[model samples]
Target: RRRTRLERSWRDCQRLWKWVSKKWLEKHRDVHNLKTIWFLRHPFKIRSGGEHKCFFCAYATKKWEENIGNRPPRTEKWTRCDYCPGRLVDSKFHCINAQYHYFNHPDLFCKEIERLNILRLRQETVGRSQGRPHA
Candidate 1:
């Protein structure tokens, strides 16, 4: 029984280590590479209180031609409107994960955007040179 308990504890430690390692990698990867904003939650936007509006503002009343705010959210955190009058503290703004990336690491975000833009320009230039229709 002691041996079994020890094995279980060891497994738990391994699981925790794996989780930590994965989180570390994800955080580091975000700053190191340029990635397209995902459209799965496309037009992602977070209001000043934590409300996710469309991809840009906190004031959106709909999401992608559908009603979103009327339904009860499954999570407790989502139940309350983040932007409801004075919910946010000074020095913080409601922002989505992608927005957080820009807010917390402007330099990294700028670098990624610059890199992606340069790549895109190169692709466009190549296409133009090859007589391909401008995309």
Candidate 2:
């Protein structure tokens, strides 16, 4: 139905993402009418608590522990809802990093990874998958 670009054309064009959606932005926009915005990094950033900041990989990772905190050690791996976006050098990488973390656990997590792999495959086969650059 829609020609899927890696992301929306406008977002890719402006390099605009880490989206603060319009409804929220509209509330803040009235503060000063928001002057000529040039390049903006993700205005919101996560701060690590206590000792460690975050794990960094050659790829990126997102804030994983925030979601499923201290579970009973999953029998399957779970990706964050936001992880479909994958890693970038700048900010957002935890989605993949948590994935990698889970990927290491052969006991329970790996099996879950396998299921997700199957789901990805099914979506791709049916042409229902969305948003990825050509590899």
Candidate 3:
């Protein structure tokens, strides 16, 4: 029984580590490289998302299509994923994930936008032959 408990705890740590690793890789793609954002609770907004069943924000992405402030979200306020037990801080990690890769690869980001089924968002990104702006 003790072994089983330890194994479960180890698995929990591994899951958190995986999330952090994903964020690190995302940072390499994004600029802030450290910023994190909250997750939009609407399952529609989240791909491969599960029922966290809470409020969400619809801010804008790039082209000015779907976003937190722009997109319509549920009104019922609930605790964010970060506050949930064993729930890694998806917001900050997510915020960094979004902004980092946004402009550098608009095409890929655009593809993601389509995946999200939101309208095209305008992303003025650098990192190509264009001068990388000091943001």
What digit string (tens of lDDT, one per residue) describes model 1 on residues 39-106?
A: 23234233331232122222222221233455556643242334211122211333223643444554
> If ranked by lDDT, best first, what sequence of candidates would result?
1, 2, 3
How many pairs of residues in model 1 come into backbone collision?
3
TM-score of each: 0.29, 0.25, 0.20
lDDT of 2 by residue, 100-130 (tens): 3432322222233334445544555556446
The most accurate candidate by lDDT is 1
Judge candidate 1 at residue 103 and give its lDDT.
Answer: 40
Better of 1 and 2 by lDDT: 1
Clashing pairs in 1: 43-55, 44-55, 49-82
Off by over 4 Å in 3: 1-3, 28-135
2, model 3: CA deviation in Å?
10
After superposition, the stretches of candidate 2 with alpha carbons farther than 4 Å from their true spots are: 1-81, 84-105, 128-135
Q: Residue 107 deviation, candidate 1, in Å?
A: 1.2
lDDT of each: 0.35, 0.31, 0.30
